[model samples]
Every structure is written in C-alpha cells, then in structure tokens.
Target chain A: MTAAAPTDRTRLRRAHERGHHDRATIDAILDATPQCAVGYTIDGAPYVTPTLHWREGDHVYWHGSSASRALRACDRAEVCLTVSILDGFVLARSGFHHSVNSRSVMLFGTAFKVTDPAEKEARLTAFIDGLFPGRTGMLRPNTEQEIKSTTILGLEIAETSAKVRSGPPKDDEEDYELPIWAGVIPVAMQAGDPIRDTRNRDGVELPAHLRGWRWPG
Target chain B: MTAAAPTDRTRLRRAHERGHHDRATIDAILDATPQCAVGYTIDGAPYVTPTLHWREGDHVYWHGSSASRALRACDRAEVCLTVSILDGFVLARSGFHHSVNSRSVMLFGTAFKVTDPAEKEARLTAFIDGLFPGRTGMLRPNTEQEIKSTTILGLEIAETSAKVRSGPPKDDEEDYELPIWAGVIPVAMQAGDPIRDTRNRDGVELPAHLRGWRWPG
Candidate 1:
C-alpha cells in the first residue's frame, strides 16, 4: 500500500519518531476503534463531539440527528476527526517522562453531508453491519422517516496522520537506573458477554456474528 | 453537587434527555477516563488531538513537550476538551435506532498556560501521583531541565456538560416486537498484567498502589 505524505497541518512537530504517514498504520488504527471525537468550528470557536465512526474504503462517516446543531455546523466545514485507542499507561522514573501507550489517527478534511438518499442509507447500513456483520440483514430495515431524520456526514481520508506509542517507557538515560517500578500496565477495551434486551422476542437468540465479534477487532 | 446551567456552547441541542449538567455527572465522566481529545482552532480551522488528562479540584490539566506546536497553539486559546468512554454497543431492531452506550463530558474554556514554576512542578507531580498514588516519592525527582521542557495547560471546569447513554437499545415502540436481536454488548477498558521495565533494578517489584489500581477507577 502506498503511504501518503503528511501535509503541513498533519505533520508532527515533536516526537516525529512516533508519527506514521503510512496508510497501513493509519487504516489499522481507524479500523480498531469505533468511537471518535470530531472537531468542528461554529462561527469561530471549536466544538468537539464524541460520535461513532466507521470507515469504508478511503472515506470515514459519522451520523447524528438531523436537528443536531453540531452536525449541521460540521456540514461542508473543515473538520478534524480523531480516533484514539489507549493501549496502556507508561510509568517512568521521572514526571517528565511519564506517557501513555496509544494509537491515534487524525484526519483533516471538509465534512461533506451525504445528501444522496441511497448513499446515506447504504452508508448507515454499512456502519451497522461493519460493526456487527450480517446483523443488518436480520434487523428491520430503516424506515423512511428514520432515514430522513438522520444526517450522515462523510470525509475523504486524505491528509491524514497516525501517531502511535507502544511497548515501554522511554525515560532519560539516568532515570532508568532509579529504584522505581517503571513499566506499562497494558490496557485494552474488552467486550463482555452479549446482553439480551429485556424486550426481545421469545425465540430470538444472540446471533453467531455477534458471538464471534470481539472488541478492538 | 450543584448543576451548572448549560451555556450556549455547552448545551445539548438534541437529546436533552441524555444531557447532564450536574457537577457530579460531569466530574465522574471526566475522572473516569484519563484520555481526552482537545479541540482548538488554528487559523480558524479546527484541530483535535488526543492527550492524557487529569483533574484537580475545579480544574483540569494536560502537559506535553514544551516544543509541541499544538501545545503552543492551545495556550491562552479557547479550546474544547472532551472525554468519552464507550460502554457498549446498542444494537436495535432498526439501523436508525442503533447507538452506543457511552459516557462523555465536554468542557469549553480558554486553555491557560501554567506559568508558575512551583505550581507547574506541583501539578505535574500531582498528575503522576494522581494516577499512581505515592509513586512520585518512590521515583527519581524531576530535574529542573525536565520541568523547563514541559508545558502544562489547564482549564477551569466551570463550563461543562456530560452526555451518557446506558442500558439496552431504545428502539421504537412497535419495532421492539421485531425478531431481530436487540441488546447491548458491554465494553470496558480492562488492564492486563503489569509488565516491568527490563532495565529495572534487581529488587524492584510492582508497587501496591499500581497492582490495586484498576482501569476506569
């Protein structure tokens, strides 16, 4: 896979060693996490909203109520969508060297509203099935009213950068010798057993796809 | 625990039912998660960056290399700090009703640079000890140069709001009778075994505070 060169805005000014411009690294981080924080401007001040995100090919998409002011502001606006996964906590001997093991991707683009009815519906279904494959086919189709009330926003995955820090702490050369317990407490998002909704139909069973799905998959 | 009235910027324009203005809910969400995305504008374009965050009293703090351009842009600038935790995937009978159980807090304020030398040092120490209590005294003290090379940014926790969604999927009344599997797959950040740094001295052991520290504590 070809790696895209970082634009001036996406370039890492510090800790350039942790910066990754390759699509493989960037796509992996994007695919690993379903939640993302979207940054968009209204008038002039910035607002960050946490929203579920999904990727399809080179475009990333998020949806919300059509009445959402933040979503309306994000339409056609230059937005920054960031997905971050906390991998671990890095403990070091010195306060300055304390860090986190994380993988994050930041994409800069104009968030174009998915106006085509067919495209919006397809993307929304892709999002659902993307997380729970084949589950969409079993679920009731989206009603026309439901589709109308939702606003789907999409951004091309261009001008992107991924930053990752893994393994252990990198303390100053001398601090490594201190009599301190310096290491990492690996952290990951784990999915518990599937919970059946109280209102489920009598014979419904937890589907096979969901049983096989795992967090950070 | 007084609930602050939502400001224009912090108000939840949609789904006000899930909106929380009380300090208890806001603080709980903020404290429950250490990773946050800070949204700030540069040249009127929004930029969101993930960073580790900690709270003290009525303020929140995050620090990074003094040479970071994003940190420099955040200083004295109006910024939005957001923390989000994905609790579960809310699978519903319809794609439109699908949602994620999440707890998120968004705080908006001017990101003030910590200029006081003593305050900076104390806050940095509090951050380390905040996550891992008593670990500061156990480790090598921060050198003067380390302090000089770190830029700490803080924001008062006044203008804040939290949005949380839990429980099973909230599908339409009629849709509940559908044969689809509707439920929540609980998700949480779980910590694995602590991996000690290879360079640790012979007698170093995983400290009590760390072993007892749980993720999402």
Candidate 2:
C-alpha cells in the first residue's frame, strides 16, 4: 500500500472516525464500482463525463475516444475523480439533518496521458482484464490504428481523501420526541438473469466465473 | 412540462431519444435520489460537494452553510449539476469497453442565490417534504437564526441532456466468437430492518409509508 500523501487537503474529517487512510479501504471502494463521473473544466466551464475505470496499485486509469474534447482537456491537467457507493439512506427525526450512509473517494491529481503505443496497449489490456479477469489472453489484441485512436490517462493518487458516513442516522436530541420514524433503507447491487446476444456463434459456453459472479461485500 | 432549453448541448445523440428529455424523465431521476454531487470550481481548482437537493418545475434547489465557498462560487456562475443512478454492470468481451447501465442528467446554467427569508423557508420545507412526504407538517419549523445561517441556490434547467445505457452489454461483433462471458449483473437497493433510537419516547408507531417505502422503477 502506498503511503497517503501528506497534505491538509488529504486529511479526513473527524480524524477519529475516518476509518484510517488505508490503501485496502480505498482499493475496495474503487473495485466495487465499475463507473465514475470524471469532473473537469474546459475554458472555466464545468463538465462531467461518466466513464468506466480500473485501479492498478495507487493509480486509476480511464479511456475515451481520441477525438473527445473533454479527454483532450483532461490530458496532463489537474483533475478531480470521484467514485461513490450509496450504501443506504439514513433517516432521522430532524428533516434538515437527514443524511445518507455512503463510501466515496475524491482523488485530486494531474493526469498523464499514455502515448507510448506498447504501454497504452498493456494498460488497456490490464484495464479490461481487471474488470473481467482471465479474458485478455483470449481476445485479439488491439491493432496499431485502434491504439492510436484511444486516449488513456492515468491519475496518481495525490491529495486523495475518503469521506464515509455509515451506520444509522443521527437526529437532533429535541426531535427524538417527535412521532416520526427513522432508520435506514439499505441499497445494494445484485446480479440479474443474463441475456445472451442473438448473434452469439455456436459452440460458446459462458465461463463459470462470469455465470456465478457476485458483487463484492 | 416546460420545454427543454434549446442548445446544441441539450440535444440528444439520437433524435428519437429526445422524447425522454421531457419533465417526467428528469423529475423521476431527481426524485429517486436525495443526494447529488454538485461540481464547481474556485479559482480554477475543481471541487465536488455532496448535498441534498430537490426539484421543482424546471429548477433544482440545494442549500448549504452561508459561508460555503462552493455555494458562493455557484451564485451567478456557470455550474454543472449531475445526478447519476447506476442500474447494473456491463460485462463486455473487452475490458476497455466494460461499462455500466446508468441514467445521468447534466445541466449547464447560472445559479442565483435565494436570499428572501420567506422564499428560503418555503424552499427548505419543500426539500424536506420531497424526501419524506408529509413529514414537514408534523415537525416544528426552522428558527429565524437557522434560516439566516443557510443559503439556498437555484439553477434553472437552461441546457440539459440525459444519457442512459441499459440492458445487456454490447460486445464487439467479432469478439462474440470468444469463450468469455458477457452479460449484465443487475443492481438494486433493498430495505433493511429498522433500528429504533435509544432515546425515542414511548407510543410512537412508524408511519405506514415509512414501513413499506420502495424505490421507483
């Protein structure tokens, strides 16, 4: 695990309840979800593009079309990447104080575009295998033109902080006397029935791992 | 329903998909989630703050401490407010193309601070009732000091677009010959057992709606 970057911006709120700046906690949250809303600015206007991401050690990687202006603006620029999991709703007696129990990580760093053809291919391969392990070797590798048309950016974990609010809701002391009810309505990600494409060719069987995969707890 | 603000940015990728831009789709996604990550920048530094929000007509409202820099920066400044709901994971043949089926709304508009005391109070009440229907009438109203310490901002839905990807994963046509599995793992939010606060008074029964609240489909 990489040591958390030391900076005032990286410090957790209520340090005691911060659950520590552990790399495992950060990695778990990143791996639990497949998508993130990448927030960046172009000409002082804020724009957010949701894209699939994967983590390798302390760095996160995402790819977009080479022609994407948002991706072009993000290359080598300071970016704020966030991934959040809505665990449950925290209902409280006081309406103003109601909150949600969630786990999220905000990473602030400058993204370095992968321009090396070999490195880009390897990173893109690792990204795919990260989400669907053991499948990289079976598919045809990206052609040179394909590699040139995709822009991959890697953001180092600098000045990153995780803010998690968990457990039950905390209502105001005075509002405890009110007759309203308060508790969590938990949210979860569950696997549904799989639908195979009609264009699937003959003699293909779904892998056991994919057929029985469950969301990490 | 108010007509969607006309702009090249608000246009849908497929014209047929433009019909989903009506008020019903926007309101349904907004009302489903109470929290949103409001993205803005101060002096070119990007910041994303999570806050509770409510929608009325073609506008969205969010409040924070009067001293909040993000809120103050948003006043009269162009802002990008996004709401995303992750429905399932897209398991594609290539990891680079792995994605999630999600619904997200991005709106670009100038925000105006709500300083009128009476209108601020009304917005606060609407925020509460929007999440927990009928509860605002049962609780005591906000005090003058509480109202004064908070600033509410409204962003008109000037230029808005909704992007949604659902159903099974879309793998490359040629990759279908590979033996790898490809399908979606559905995700959902489920209710949990309620935990009564230790300080609760006697004879307070949970409301009927609270007992069986469900996430909209």
TM-score per candidate, chains pooled = 0.97, 0.87
lDDT tens per residue, model 2, A1-217: 7658555545653434844466777778888876676878877777776676888877899987797776888898878888877777776776556667788877888888989999999888887666556666765566788789899998987677776788776776777777766767676666666666555556666765566666654
lDDT tens per residue, model 1, A153-178: 99998899999999889888977777
TM-score of chain B of 1: 0.96
**Local distance difference test values of all predictions, in order:** 0.89, 0.73
DockQ of 1: 0.87
- Listed models, DockQ each: 0.87, 0.47
Query: lDDT tens string, model 2, B24-110?
Result: 677777777765767787778666665667888878999977876668888998788888777777767765556677777777788
Once model 1 is optimally superposed onto the true structure by TM-score, how far is the C-alpha of residue A200 displaced, in angstroms? Answer: 1.0
Kindly report the docking quality category of candidate 2: acceptable
User: Which segments of candidate 2 are over 4 A away from where they belong?
Assistant: A2-8, A11-24, A138-140, B2-24, B94-97, B169-180
Docking class of 1: high
Instruction: Report the error of model 1 at residue A175, Å.
Output: 2.6
lDDT, residue B32, model 2: 72
